[model samples]
Target: MVKKQDQVTHNAKPTAVESRGGKSTIAIKGTFPEKYFAKKATMTITPAIKNYNGEIKQLTPIDFQGEKADGKGQIINYKEGSGFNSVQNIPYDPAFGKSILVLNSTVKKGEKEIKLNEKEIGEVNMSTKRQDIDPKLVYKNQTSDGTNYYFSEHNYIPNNLVVKTATIFFDFNSDKLNWNLPFNQKEENKQALSELFPFLMDYDSIQSIDIEGWASPEGELRRNQQLSNNRSLVGKKWFEKELESYLKKQSKETKSFMKRLTYKLYDKGEDWDGFINALKNANIEDKDKIINVIQSQATKIQKEQQIQNMIAIYDEIDQKILPCLRRSYFKISCVENLRTDEEIMRLVNISPDSLTKNELLYAASLTNDMEMKKKIFSKAIELHPEDYRGYNDLACIKVAEGKTDEAKKLFENANVLKSNNDVVLNNLGIMSYQDKDYGKSEKYFNESQKAGMDQSKNLALVKDTIYTIDYQTKPDIEETANDDKTKKQKSEDD
Candidate 1:
């Protein structure tokens, strides 16, 4: 086949054909105009095959001579037959079913070179047919959730107060707190007092203190009231003296801390409530009868008289309950400070163990780098295996990495730790959707929505996927009808 200028034409028969191998040699002929070959030029002809997929396979490159100036100052003309006539062997290739010949020519004079127009000079159509290939879905990385879980700092106190109460008893009819009381002489009382002394000295360490004083019920109503009030005053005075002594021994910084301290005093007169509580819990005989008498009596004096009349159980009451009534109760609450964000971040790298589980999880959320997030989350899970946030966040990293199975397992583990975690459930739903488990995906999405997760976008995506699947699988009735009508018309025409 030969393509003339601005037109393509084919000869009736091949120039030469090999009988044994069936390889055909086709002659390609073309001529350049005089001005085109005036300069000393070089020409190259390349034969190639173009496949159905738009890829080209080269056959062979042919070089041609150019016009050159002779020693006699005359031009040695490059004739058409010598420079443009060439034959190319076309081989059988399933992919290269269509072939073409391209011509490229360059002109050179001394150091200057110029490229001529490259042209498609010839074409051939082979007998082979092109094969069909199936298309596939290309996998793409998904965007991150951009949601972060931070550790709550405000109103969050880490240290819990170890509650210790010290009770000092008073003798019957006495309003003063005896320093030499038997209860005060006990080792536990000394330990309790020791635990409370430091908090009293450092105002920053203590939140508050409550002092309550009580008197036994077997007394005059007015006398008992006066006794409870004086006992509360005496108890408060003793603590104030102890605090003053503590401040005297401390430096100015600690002495000044007393300014922030707060104190509350309560006078529990007659201790009737304490008496009823003691009676309810006591292991003595006629307990129900004593409780009934106390409940039935309308007046405080009548109750006292009824209690004093229980001569058999009076010893039990004096030894077991009355001493508890004639006493002072001191309750001290201490302040707990939380670590700052900067301090927690600094320690996370150097000493991660120093940070709480929430702090470690929060550190992961503070950075956008995936590798750093993975490291922090790994450390969080290692430190606190029971917390679900660590597992859920780490699973997000796995999902971004295209490890869907690993992400599913991590999400399941997170779910086991904290059942129905919104983030975990949402991620699992996404995984199921990606795997084409539509029913399972819908189930997870519904559950996630119930768990307070925003699944509107995810649900929309699932609906779209279902529609696409249905559309692709459904039959085309119009196309089938048209095909049948065309077949019948062709039969009638035949």
Candidate 2:
């Protein structure tokens, strides 16, 4: 009996398709009817790419043949195995929208050859959807160094001078500034007083003078309170006398030019806080017990009694700690010589090295022109190579100019200078995402967030890209099932 054409069937489907580095490999599994064996049977599979422009390109084909049966009229069954398979690698282009895997099978019996089946096994999306560059990521503003001082409507340029502080030790239980005492006779004390004289005489106006008087915690609370107040008053009087003497020595024009100075006095009675702070650094025994007693004591009298009972510790405290507590702490705040904007602009162009790192950074912020900003940042990095802000800001300029590779290198250098910098990490993530490395980009974005970067927008972009790539690579179960049903019906009709 002759078998009907409808009794023989062929099936072809792609097992998997893997894509990377602008290339893809498609693996196909083909099946022939168990009872349909011929002397010579051949299967050919071809891969093709359809680009967005509707252009189609054919790739190399894969061919496989079945072995002939032993004798004429001998029925050999084709077993289910990997013998009917085809593997082809095709060049993947980002511009291409889809990759098509085509399958064809033919059978040769006696002197006649007949086609069996021809179908498309599967198709995968080759196009990649890239997200738009985030504006925030492309134009990161440089961070401030927090050294710029603002006064009134003008920016105060630091003269490289720090706030000056002076301490004056007093005699035991005494509040007066004992000028004749040996402690006060030290050269440091003389220099401190002399420095105060010139500061008042030279500056047109002093910002403020804070006099904080502290007394040892061993005495009665009320006595200690009065003693601290008296010490602050006496310290203020000494400064007043010194200023008067200095002004008397100054010319009349100098006195006329000086502005009225402001002063504040604070009586910090019983320097208990300072005492505890000192004990933390002290190497004396029973330090923990002392600290515990001090913290646990509810009243000043209780604390004083507890400390007095520790007589063995008192000698050390008296010699090492108490002397330092019986003193007045004073700080003088003064206005620094400031530069005008005109002068800063001129100096930035002429002598950028003269400006502080903060000044150079601030100068960059002052201008809207990209070229000027770049020049200012160049000078800033030249002068302060150790500071990562200069490199970070320069990288932002590179990004805005579409020099992404250069920006990436700059960000890497910045990260080397300041490891785990939020801005540098975020920019690196952006570069990775643009390169279609979604996993690497996600890793970088997460790290940037851990480093304190505000990466919500960039993270969302990465997630969207990942979803797009995943959907493109893996077929949906429902869609694949429907496709199988359609192919089966078509095969049966044929």
- Give the best candidate by lDDT: 2
RMSD per model, one decimal? 25.6, 12.8
For each candidate, what is the lDDT? 0.63, 0.65
Name the regions of candidate 1 deviating beyond 4 angstroms: 1-165, 179-182, 185-189, 199-206, 244-252, 334-494
- TM-score to true structure, per model: 0.42, 0.51
Q: For residues 300-322, could you state the per-residue lDDT of candidate 2 as single tens digits?
A: 89998876776455686766677
Which stretches of model 2 miss by more than 4 angstroms? 1-99, 102-118, 121-132, 137-206, 220-263, 273-303, 311-324, 335-355, 379-387, 416-420, 437-494
Model 1 pairs whose backbones collide? none
- Residue-wise lDDT of candidate 1 within 406-481, one digit each (tens)? 8789888988998876666766776777677767877888888898867776666555421000011012434666
* CA lDDT, candidate 2, residue 472: 31
What is the number of backbone collisions in each predicted candidate, taken in the order shown? 0, 0
